[model samples]
Target: MQTFDQVIQSNIALIQKVVDFDAKNDQLLPLDFTAANTELTDEILDDTDLFSDWVNEKLAKNNASYGIGGYNEHRTIYSRSTHFDTEEEPRRLHLGIDIWGPAGTPIYNFYDATVQSFAFNDNLGDYGATIILTYDIDGFKFNALYGHLSLASLNGLEEGKFIPAATKIAELGAKEENGSWPPHLHFQLIKDMGGLKGDYPGVCKFSEREKYLANCPDPDLILKVTFS
Candidate 1:
């Protein structure tokens, strides 16, 4: 059996349909949650509204449609309560690629898949409205997680139903509905969900980077936005 990463890389055309990647009109933005920026300090990162405004301004300035990045990123923004564990090392390494865009922006299925599960994880600084889709390519089975979506996105969705490739599945959620963070889609591919439903860890501890990254490979194999 081909490895999950190999499966995606070998068939980039099928996986590339998850988002509209127009190199000409669509500009890719890389977000920095670390303290490298003199202006974006820890206090500002803690404030979602301010951070969202800052991000939006940059998008506007660049005339970009999305603010992307976060795969394997050592982010400081996880200092928020919901992302950190008191008894263990903080989960700072992000395992997903975040596409920042306006609320209600439509998200499409890259391939024919079923709605494995969906839920509203209303935690502070967490994936609020989430969806997990299962895919079977050849004999390899993998999953994808769409996080920070509108609560209503889960309405009427059932497991074992087919969602065609490029089908408009859900819209991005507003900050009020998306766990009080800036509107964005947290897209993650999982080799195995480890028997979980409706959610999976998008962030992991820096110490266990090797294991987490192996399970969650670079999403760009599918996203194909190396431009970010």
Candidate 2:
């Protein structure tokens, strides 16, 4: 018996482009949002405008089109919003890959899937407009989540909508629409949704890292974008 990830790896060639990542025209830059970065100061994180400016500056400095990364990353940037706060502990560990780019950057369906769910998580530091698609490969079923998407992406979306492979499903949302973060697409692969609809925990408490990480696999498996 093969695991869900094993099935995905075996059929990697079938996955489609989720974003337009051109090697010649687009430079993929890896961004660090963890505590160790030291570059993300209090001023930047405290203000959404400043934070957006900082992201743009970094990409411009590196001459990159997209600032990417954040899978399984234990970050401290969540401190800016109480949305992730809990009595036990803050969910500071990221469970998805974030591709920072300009708002409205197009996003495509990576597989032939049915729209499992969609919603507007309007809380501050939330995913804002989010979409989840269910896919079947080699008889194994799973879900791919596209978060921080423009509210327009949800315009005509409905449950069980069939989207062909490589279809333009959504676009990146602006700071005001993407939970007040710098423009980026939060992509995650989930083996099981645990009966949730339209949303799941993209960030987890550090203490329960193992349990959450086990359910959420590395999104790079599908993204296939190399970084510095």
Candidate 3:
């Protein structure tokens, strides 16, 4: 079995930012609820879309990287519904690590990779703006996907653009452009997504956890940083 530590030693700083923070941070604070059993109301979840719009509007206003949703926080802080559909379903098991921060925060390439593809997902509950990078490490070819980015990030970029390690590929988008929620980055490692382009499932059902988990290992392996 490969450890996440072994796989992600090359990029530790970026990894730690995602893993080492309480979801209730002052800047990217989680919602305040009274009881543990507090169910997310439709209004709260709807704020996600409103937030996404606000992010986009702000980006248009000031042009920044602090938008919401990514691999760092998982799904808990985002208030997204629809856990993987299956028997014995795990409620909102996160498939990616979310980088919770303000919109327009700079996002860097963890390693050398080529621009695989990108798109504006545009659905109400979608990534809004997304990009994918493909690279090979020690004969292991794999991909990294950056979801919920500013529309400007896609400007002048195309497939096969050679992105160097630590290159600023894009900025974290605001909620408006990042599927309408708080600003964050949804980072995921994919082994095989069956040739899907510009989009892939970052969340999966509990019944399929074993299979999905194997295909998608902990991204922290490449990030090489711990939250705690």
Query: Each candidate's lDDT (Cα)?
Result: 0.83, 0.91, 0.64
Q: What's each prediction's TM-score?
A: 0.93, 0.97, 0.70
Per-residue lDDT of model 2, residues 137-212, tens digit only? 9898889899999999999989999999999999999877889998899999998999999999999999999999
Worst 10 residues of 3 by lDDT: 26-35
Q: Where is model 2 more than 4 Å wrong at Cα? A: 226-228
Whichever of 1 and 3 has more lDDT, that candidate is 1
Off by over 4 Å in 3: 1-7, 10-41, 49-91, 224-228
Residue 153 of model 2 has an lDDT of 94
With candidate 1 superimposed using the best TM-score fit, by how many Å does residue 8's alpha carbon deviate from the native?
Answer: 2.2
lDDT tens readout by residue for model 1, 1-228: 677767766877676366666878789888776646567776767888897898899899999889996688888777755656647677888999999998888888988899999988888888999999999887788889999999888888998878988898888998877877889999998888899998899888889999988888787777876554
Return the TM-score for candidate 2, rounded to 2 decimals.
0.97
Rank by lDDT, descending?
A: 2, 1, 3
lDDT of 3 by residue, 1-228 (tens): 445445455434433233233344323322222224245454655677554454456545543323323332224433343322435553344566666556777878877789888998876556778998887765567788888789888998889999887677888787668876577777888877688999987776555567877777777666433334
Instruction: Give the lDDT of residue 53 in candidate 3.
Output: 57
